[model samples]
Target: MPKMKTKSSAKKRFKVSATGKVIGSQAGKQHGMIKRSNKFLRNARGTTALSAPDAKIIKGFMPYDR
Candidate 1:
């Protein structure tokens, strides 16, 4: 059988932790930061785990992970 490839876009944007959680960057951090409040900027600085439904979908794209 042929190897299933990981989705290139998913690989770049998401991370799977050792415990099987999906970790990703917060939104609104990509551009136009000047208009955002300090709190928004502070809150957008870390990775967050995906919800169960979201994780399930992402799992398909990340073939090597659960």
Candidate 2:
């Protein structure tokens, strides 16, 4: 069979963790941070693990990552 192509967008946006979880940057922080609460900004400061359902979908896009 031919090689499977990884989704370029997924490769750029998400990463497969060592334990097989999908790690991605938190959403809603790309713009308008001035309107957001300090707590919200603090909480969203780092990468987050994608939820199970969401990770499943991302995994499909990155078949070779796992």
Give the alpha carbon lDDT tens digit for every residue of 1-66 in model 1: 999999999999999999999998888888999999999999888889989999889999999876
Best model per lDDT: 2
Candidate 2 lowest-lDDT run of ten: 37-46
RMSD of every candidate to native, in Å, equals 1.2, 0.6
User: How far out, in Å, is residue 28 in model 2?
Assistant: 1.0
Candidate 1 collision pairs: none
Give the distance in Å from residue 13's predicted Cα in candidate 1 to where it truly belongs: 1.4
Q: Write model 2 residue lDDT over 1-66, tens digit each, in one string.
A: 999999999999999999999999999998999999999999998899999999999999999999
TM-score of 2: 0.96
Clash count per candidate: 0, 0
Off by over 4 Å in 1: none
